[model samples]
Target: MSTNTVAGVRPAAEPTASQGAAAAFRGAVAAEWTKLFSVPSTWWTMLAGLVVMAASALQLAIYAANDNTNDDPLDDRGIVTVGSVVIDSVELTQYAVLALGLLAITAEFTSGTIRTTLQCTPARGRVLLAKAVVAGAVTFALGLLLGGVGALVARPTLGGWGSAPAAGTIGDIVAVATYLALVGVLALGLGAALRSAVLTITVLFAILMIVPLSLMEPDIAVLNRIADVFPGVAGGHFMAGDTEPYPGAVGLLLLAGWAGAALLLGRAALRRRDA
Candidate 1:
């Protein structure tokens, strides 16, 4: 079978079905990228997140400056964890990305833009995956910038304090970028599944914030154990570099599991439901 014939004939095997499908998937990704940035809200959300990061770093610096009693070795521990301040800013950054992820799909549904989206990309799974990819990429970049600038701005806060964060701690801080991206993907999945901005955002916030609070209030042995492994708690270890029950890898895997499960549920919802 000749792929290219010289005898004025259409190519017998120009591309396989899988190749066509791959091309369609790529097109969906491109469409999602365009749609994501085309809206003004996306830029505003990212800018607000950066502002939060900067303000948070500055706030921590002010607090450190106010601590005028640290002329001892043991006391330096108080300021050496300045990196923790960077991690704190992740909360605001994560929330911003989560909103971006949720709105990426839910806004489409709310404004009835989803119908047009479905018309263009009939494969619902591709649409969802594309949204996830776009959301993940944007958040990863945002998180890196946030983490870097956060550390730089807070470095002065740790001046004349304990030794600098070691290489491993630096790696963990960098891992915060991946953690943020995963959080965004998780929100994107929830958005796809719920298709309502208010409900989706509420549920996400509850999962990330309220559920742990409720679980901790009981203080039961089993409940406390469960709370320790909750996505938010486990995920924090990634950036905070806290190693009590497990290492950073465990934190990353736990958070990644959260994101994977959400995306699967979202895909199922998109496939089973009508737009």
Candidate 2:
């Protein structure tokens, strides 16, 4: 027998701490993904969003097509912007997107499954990050679907209205998808911290819709500035490629900042509080 060998075999090396942590995080993400897709409400909410977007697209397209005051549809200086029609449909359907994100985490808490999740993962931050990853991804896809469907449904009527440049239309669709992805992560963060579906949904709705609408007046410079920073308004500016208040890129950064802040808040709560 060789001195360096024992029974012609060697013991396996133990995994490093980093490798162990990585494995745990990956497992957590897989669990979160399974939980999200397995729910019936997830499909229903997404379907509702699709229906709303299609309906809104039809309505907006019809209205745009009926406008005969414009001397030239190609000039489109006074006519409705085709990009706006796509964005408007997305706006009408975004609630379902938010609901999908919120439910991912809140449902776990509501059903007492979060405790089980935490027990399995042990590291709360990993669990929350996993939820964020899964929610953000699914909602990003939802955004793309909604945006594409809306554009296709409206293009037949509004295709000539305004400039309807292919580049601009494509940009708007991408922006819509990006915005919805950030909004989904934001909702997931809020859900993790609040742990109540109803309350989180209500608060998120107010932040995205009610507050922005209430501050819509441009007369007040202060209010206008505040409104411009809200995720909903910022997302609108991004999708429309508006330069007012800030460039579309800046608007995207602002929305991303909001999502980052929410995730940080959720991380703190998850680490400090018991599941």
Candidate 3:
């Protein structure tokens, strides 16, 4: 045991494995956050997404208002389904979050910053995990803002069509935000594994939209059952927040499972593949 003299106390004890891992994760998060904010594309994408959401919401509200005869207020029959009117908007705009997630990781590779990033965090899994956290957080925040504002703006018109959600407006809005976060994180994991922007985005799109639709054949019960587990389908069901093919709890769990498995796969690929 080497001990320092000259009025110097013994060196600080080394951290345990768990402590070391926690510290590393924190550092990785800070680094990834810096990288994420430095990019101009993120700002552009978020701006574009918000613009689309606002436009669509206004259009829906206007259409609803015009449809009424002699300015009679609409009932709660059509406007309120599966929770809040905002939920429909939240679910429809899910693709934006998925794209944001893919870009969070794939952009690094596209810009050749991935090498530098891996060098900073040699533990590839830590890098992927940090990206997931950052991306998921960003999507959640965006979801809240979009869903809350869109819902509020359109609520009066939508209210005529249906009653307020039993779950409360705030709860439904927050649930949509959480669902966006989960979907975003899953896309981040797929980005890490694919390491290509185009491929990751296409695959995510297919999983979220095309696959389930294509598999829906009136005669094929088994195909529909298989589609039930896809992260997008499961998450979409949850967003409906009402009667669904799968229970709400099961839908959430399935979405979580997809994100976790994809993250693990990404970690494995990051470790094994050349940067």
Which one is best on lDDT?
Answer: 2
Ranking by TM-score: 2, 1, 3
Query: lDDT of all predictions, in order shown?
Result: 0.81, 0.85, 0.78
Model 1 lDDT, residue 45, Cα: 91
Model 3 misplaced regions, further than 4 Å: 1-12, 62-83, 162-167, 217-219
Q: What is the lDDT of candidate 1?
A: 0.81
lDDT of 1 by residue, 38-63 (tens): 99999999888888888887787666
TM-score, predicted candidate 1 vs. hidden true structure? 0.88
Q: What TM-score, over all chains together, does every model reach?
A: 0.88, 0.89, 0.86
> Residue 209 deviation, candidate 1, in Å?
1.3
Note the residue pairs that clash in candidate 2: none
Q: Highest TM-score: which candidate?
A: 2
Q: Tens digit of lDDT per residue, candidate 2, span 73-179?
A: 66444456566788987777888899988898888878888888888988888888998999889999888888888887887876556446788777788788898
Number of clashing pairs per prediction, in order: 0, 0, 7
Pairs of residues clashing in candidate 1: none
Model 3 C-alpha lDDT per residue in residues 220-246, reported as the tens digit of each score: 889998888888778777766545677
Worst 10 residues of 2 by lDDT: 73-82
Distance from true location, Cα of 23 in model 2, Å = 1.3
